[model samples]
Target: MPVVLSLNIAQRTVPVDYAQEGATGIDKRPVDGPLDVRAPGPKGTAGSGVAGDAIADIVHHGGEHQAVYAYAREDLDWWQAELGTDLRNGQFGENLTTSGIDQTHARIGERWRVGTALLEVTAPRIPCRTFAGFLGRTGWVKRFTQVARPGAYFRVREPGTIASSDEITVVHRPEHDVTVELFFRAVLTEPALLPRLLEAGDSVPPEIIDLVHRRTTVQLDS
Candidate 1:
């Protein structure tokens, strides 16, 4: 249940230095590390929500795992066009990008061991305004939603160092037929899938599951 591949990293604050990276300040964090990560505050950034990690402008962060992405091992000239050019060459904001597995199928509570690092699938990323802006389209969020097959985010369950090209081995894949993508889709369109999502509710975060319930309510009313 594992399809290991290479790994890489890049700075997200390009064209904007620590001084000019704006309020968000680049949003940089280690690809795989413990939660509550911090960094050295940017100049004059006393309380700019930027963690004071060793890295400068270590702001604009997320929870245990800020970002995640997936791709097929082979060249993605075609997949690139669909996901936009920013992620075609594996240069997106993703912390871990690899091939050989159906990432959307990674259910909650599932875990993987890449090199020595232990990662657990937390949830599918909810497309945000930042992502829409990064791709330069107001409808980018909707487009991404239509596809809704993005990889799953992983919490660094284990703290260990891993180099690029390490194999990703899947240690578990529970009895979750309703994948992350399916849940995302049901929340988006299908009302019938709501029950399944609700049945598997415990596996998903309460906030997200609550959102699905909200949507179901609206659809029922309509």
Candidate 2:
């Protein structure tokens, strides 16, 4: 059984030279106990899972499609060596740091029950300038992209409280070939894999689904 290694939350803080106003919740630290998990309302609405958790950059951070972010502890271990730095649970900006789970290969639309809430894997986090800025590493975006273990974002299906050490069990997995890694590669590294994303059906987020549809339509028309 996969387990939640840590429950992390952060208050907004503007670290010097962070390049963004307000605190980037990326510097999340582990909390002592159970934390509420719920949808952050609509896309434009701002909300946080933990009571004091902050989402400073609202535009790209919150919403139903990305309510909670999960990163594998193993992946963090991998980065520890690569970056020669100590990384804790929320270091990657993930809400839930998990162990014994292969987040990269998790099929899109897969459902995992953590504590009482049910979460469905919605999309792979695409690295952005904000993430690179957080790390403050040279060529970090490219380097992170190349590693291709970008953590998975999950939408809350059944809202409830989750605590550290709670068992994470897979409840459902859609029949699809579009794993998180495949989706990442399809969009960022290999455009040719775009069509394969269609296999995941409704599991893929609307934004990605639309993008893939538009691209495939163009290819067909040509």
Candidate 3:
């Protein structure tokens, strides 16, 4: 059974050279209390789905589509071994650190009943310079992209309180095979896979759908 290993939120913003605001909330820490989860309106106006969690980069982070971020503890452990360092929950800026769940292969549009909240998988967390700078690792973006286990972003469907150790139940899964891993590859590395994303239909993020359209138009013109 999959469960939320930790419910984390940014305790304080830390100054960083990479963020546009000169600070970032990437250094999240686990919180013991339950958090109210809800759609934080739209990007630029919204912050984090979890109440009290901070999103310093409104232009690039947060919103309904990316209302919440989840990362598998298994993946984090793998990184811990690979980097030869102790990695903790929410270290990757995820709101939920999950265990016993394969977030990489989680299909787009999959619904998970977490606590009393219903979350729908929407997109993958793209590696950014902020992430690289936070880790202080050279070529971190490229390295993370190469691995393609970028974690999962989700939209809040039913607002509720979620706390650490809440069980994660897969209530629904879309029929298409466009998993989070595939979507990451399609958007970042392989343009050929973009067309296949259509199989997921409207569940595919609008920005990605736009990319697909642009590619299709360019190919036709050529």
Candidate 4:
């Protein structure tokens, strides 16, 4: 059993100062330290256009892994084991933090119970220009995209109030070839990753799948 270092839940508004309309510019700014958990999204609330769990868009807050998140608490703690990190807020640049279990072996279509909310792991966050800002370097986005460690997103199966440090349990797991890690890796390196994600997107977060489809389209057009 892994321990959840910390738990954080916030509201996501929209029209954030840096997060824009399109997929290309969603991630911006580096969030630092922790803010009140009562606010929407991480740190503070955003605009109206982008609100919810699937979109924990971060901008200039933390330093290590800005805008990182986990839909299921099990995966959140599990990933801490795999990453060998304490799941610290400022350390990992994680805007939204969780504790419970690991997510290294989790996949899409998987179901998890966290507190009163039941959710399914949807898709991985694909790094972009905004990610580079966290590193304060150029091309780091490409490097991170290459490693494919983007965390998981869960769709609310049963909606309820979710508090910090709640217990998470797995209800179902998918029989897919790709792990969450592989999905992130494949999405960035292999064009084939798109087709698989597209099919599974039905169960994934629409925003994330939309990103996969958008990137695939960009690749095709290019």
Give the candidates in order of TM-score, highest first: 3, 2, 1, 4
Q: Residues 1-222, candidate 1, lDDT per residue (tens digit)?
A: 344444434433444322334333223333443223122122233221112222123333344433233444432444467656534333334445566666677676676787676666656666656655544566867877877665665655665555446668888776767677776776666657766766554555555667777877898899
lDDT by residue (139-183, candidate 4, tens digit) is 767655654556665555564444444566788877765567766
For model 1, the stretches where C-alpha displacement exceeds 4 angstroms are 1-61, 64-77, 83-90, 198-203, 212-222
The pairs that clash in candidate 1 are 4-168, 6-165, 38-53, 39-51, 39-52, 39-53, 40-52, 40-53
Better model by TM-score: candidate 1 vs candidate 2: 2
Among all candidates shown, the one with the greatest lDDT: 3
Lowest lDDT block of 10, candidate 3: 200-209
Best by TM-score: 3
Per-candidate total of colliding backbone pairs: 8, 1, 0, 26
The TM-scores, one per candidate, come to 0.64, 0.92, 0.97, 0.58
| Tens-place lDDT digits, model 2, residues 72-161 | 999999999988999988998888899999999999889999999999898898887768888888788899889999999888889988
Q: How well does candidate 1 match the true structure in TM-score terms?
A: 0.64
lDDT of 1: 0.52
For model 3, what is the C-alpha lDDT against the true structure? 0.91
**What order do you get sorting by lDDT, best first?**
3, 2, 1, 4
Better of 1 and 2 by lDDT: 2
Worst 10 residues of 1 by lDDT: 47-56
Q: Per-model C-alpha lDDT, please?
A: 0.52, 0.84, 0.91, 0.49
